[model samples]
Target: MERESDVDALIAEGAAAPVDGWAFDWLAGRAAEERPPWGYARRVATRMAAARAALDVDTGGGEVLAELPQSPPLLVATEGWPPNVTVAARTLRPVGGRVVAVTPGAPLPFRDAAFDLVVSRHPVRTDWAETARVLRPGGTFLSQQIGPGTVRELSEAILGPLPPPADRHPERAVADAEAAGLRVVDLREATLRTVFHDVAAVVWFLRKVVWTVPGFTVERHRPALVRLHDRIRAEGPFVAHARRFLVEAIRPAD
Candidate 1:
């Protein structure tokens, strides 16, 4: 029991630290490389090429939006992080895109039926109700998001046992869309595989890049770091497998 407690302590300590610059830089680079080619942006762009206006929620780095062949009249991007928003806006503005930095968990700033297409990649918003609320009749809502198994190994090593494996609810995004009177179109799940140079890289990514959960303090994370290093030495380089879902739904043409 003492050994188990010790291990748990180590895990917590290793995960401590506010995720900031180093983490985002590391994650941005990795996201650029390993994110699926047929990801959220492509999927949404393909479906909405004819639309007059479009919005991308949480447009990190604007890489996905940049891939579109023809830009929308209103190529608006919404970001929650001020720094990231500034960076993304700087990168995207050259291409005639506009950026809006919003407070987290707040309703989006758009009129009803304002957009013909709305897309998001791993949006931090708990539910898609707002997404559905903002879409015009016949507008499309497309998203690709990380599911529950996003960092199973890391979570286990650092945070102790995790909840039982279950399909990510995405806060009932689908149901929210339906309640808003959107028609369910298509939904699919894919397992994504990512390789890390080392366990430290993986840990760095979880802390910096992913930033899924908050409240990791340095004292809490130190022991976890030690355990992770020891585990890596024992187990060899880390390979992370994550489950992601791609969902597409459309507002009915009334």
Candidate 2:
């Protein structure tokens, strides 16, 4: 049972795979996920072109921040994990932005009214109060966030059926931003197709994207992995839906 070559490959590749940055190129052929039409990276680059000062929160390895077409005059990014902090600093240096290792859920290290634009792709948790505290009046906040029940199919494959998502709704984001004194000008949500061609792809995915199934390991979830492998071989590809939301808010000029 444990000596299956395909399963062994899956476990070995996943366990050895690098899960440092936010980039997902490793999943290119083995897995695929549709992109949101709104183009969050393009939006972020546009915002960066206009803003003098900006902050990128929870910038995993600063990979996304490094992709900005034009760098802002004062750009800063934050990461909570120590390993990611090192990686982020290296990646962000060329863009002239520094990565600050911050404590998750702690107050941001920056002073009040320090930045005119604040952006994050998918933060662990959005501290609206800190976001509002750092953003200057009339500043903009643009983010593409993970929505409720993203990749539920993959999740259930790993951990069996689960309850609906409780935390990641976009409506709650609007309320929080509003409470933080930011005007929510736009909100959009999308559910996109996601597919895994093989068990290794799924294994690598879960290992890299920890939130999919925290503490997942080949030894721990071998049975589930075997079942999923069988399903992929019988069917074409394991299909799932990924949901994401985009929110654009502005701090009032007043």
Candidate 3:
């Protein structure tokens, strides 16, 4: 059994840790999440091996991209968050990839038909038209996206009952892909089990994933966090389900 002081220390440690870059090393073993069965990283490595030029959108810290066993000759990545851009540049340097600081919802800084393959993992937003424009004939776009209402169990723990998501369904994504003149070759969705072993884990996650509560701060949500902490102390770990989806599209060979 953890003492109250110990728990408070953990929470403070989590709150002070840098949330920049997508790396979650801080949460190692503190929380666990089931991975989607599709093995997105291995799939990306396979595709990268066959491409001549590739771009990665919203490449947070280049953590996933840097792990690729192989990379295309011309590798480029974009990051919207400034802190992550620096981290990504450093992480991707050894892999010979360039990182661009991009503005959210703004145009991608690349030429039309510039890449043969484009990939992103959990992009903040998918610019379907820009994705189509950047791909050469017969190029492919592969992404693992956070589906609607991901981690609602955690979000609602902090904020009270919320409205249901109106969009981000795979069907909507397919329609948008088709509308952008890309063919949706494959798409899949999954709900994975997630467990926060401690309140500190929950606090760290909410801070890193800002969308969870929009404006989650230790001070603002301390009351809710305390409530959750008490619940954990009594009920073991807090359980939640994380939603994710995989979408693959290809530009027509014509």
Tell me the TM-score of each prediction against the true structure: 0.80, 0.97, 0.97
lDDT of 2: 0.91
Give the per-residue lDDT of model 1 (tens digit) for 86-142: 677777776678888888888899888889888887766534677777888878888
Q: For residue 240, what is the lDDT in candidate 2?
A: 97
Candidates 1 and 3 compared: the better one by lDDT is: 3
* Residue ranges of candidate 1 with Cα displaced over 4 Å: 1-38, 165-167, 209-213
- Regions of model 3 farther than 4 Å from truth: 1-7
Against the true structure, candidate 1 has what lDDT?
A: 0.67
Write down the RMSD of all candidates, one decimal each: 5.4, 1.4, 1.5
Looking at model 3, the pairs that clash are: none
Cα lDDT of model 2 by residue, 1-254, tens digit: 55488777876786688888888888888999999999999899998999999999999988888888799999899999888999999999998998898899999999999999999998888999889899999999999999998999999999999998998999999999999899999999999999999888888899877888989888899899989988888888999999999999998999
Best by lDDT: 3
In the predicted model 2, the residue pairs found to clash are none
